[model samples]
Target: MTVDRDSLTELRDLARAFAAERDWGPFHTPKNLAMALTVEAAELAEHYQWLPTGADHELDERKREGIRHELADVLLYLIQLADQSGVDLRAAALEKMELNRLKYPADQVRGDARKYTEY
Candidate 1:
């Protein structure tokens, strides 16, 4: 999933509207958004807690839907946090991917699971 800039912008606007409609702007400080994002991420992780390494690929429809909802929650919170913090999520992700490519060069790290520092 590559989400375009327009989609991210739409998500950000939706998140902003949701917060505003609920009079949540005052409570949506960067710290609070970050904490909420972490919580949502944990919730998403919980859905896969006891699954086998490749179990996700075999999820039943109901379980897949549950995972989908959890993923949505995680994404929504992340979008809200990024919007509140004035961070461009798409750009940051791309930049980080570039940095990761440098850190974990394919030829050296191929089929390896060690940290970059270990290489």
Candidate 2:
């Protein structure tokens, strides 16, 4: 299947097919997927761990490529986790964004970094 960068559904389908092909569904329990997702996210964060503030702005091509691959790993595991848990990943993201808008209203939280409770 064609994997379009814009399509979360396609990514989720691909991840499902990949696990099915490997008979890995049994191993992809929600807990396992969540742990794996966290590991991958840490790996992604590792790329920037030692960088000075704003150093990411100067990432060389090799560093950028490494970051891209790590990001993909994090995303794939997230999609798999959402799939195994019967969540529509895209819809959840949209829903979370709406919640964020309510919690951090633009007029009140504009230019602020504090939590909603702090305001």
Candidate 3:
């Protein structure tokens, strides 16, 4: 699904509902959620850990689906943590992008993989 605010809201609601149904709300604090998000991210990374660079493009359908599910899990936890913490994720993301733009101006950084500080 698209990563717009409306879609994120929908996913957030679904996540909240899923947790509510299982009485997991008490354990869904920001810290716990953040940790879970990190774990899920690690799990997602595992799918590509041993692959050579560019090998991700060769993943078959099943591996792709596995990655998709891990991504979804990471997103769900992030949405949940953002919701619980009263964060406006879209705005924060846009603001961060603007900061990155200043740090890595296109004309100077194009085709360069170096850190902004290195340049």
| TM per prediction | 0.88, 0.89, 0.90
Ten contiguous residues minimizing lDDT sum, candidate 1: 53-62
How well does model 2 score by local distance difference test?
0.88
Better of 2 and 3 by TM-score: 3
Candidate 3 lDDT, tens digit per residue, 1-119? 76655777888889989999999999999999999999999999888876786276778788899899999999899999999999988788899999999999999999999999898
Tell me which residue pairs clash in candidate 3: none
Tens-digit lDDT string for candidate 2 (1-119): 96456578888879889989999999999999999999999888877877885276768888889889989999999998898889988889999999999999899989999989998
lDDT of residue 87 for candidate 2: 92
- What is the Cα-based lDDT of residue 23 in candidate 1? 100
Residue 108 error, candidate 1, Å: 0.7
- Write one digit per residue (lDDT tens) for candidate 1, span 8-114: 88999988998899999999888988888788888777777777862858677877888798889889888888887889999999999999999999999999999
- For TM-score, candidate 1 versus 3, the one ahead is 3
User: For model 2, what is the alpha-carbon lDDT of residue 35?
Assistant: 98
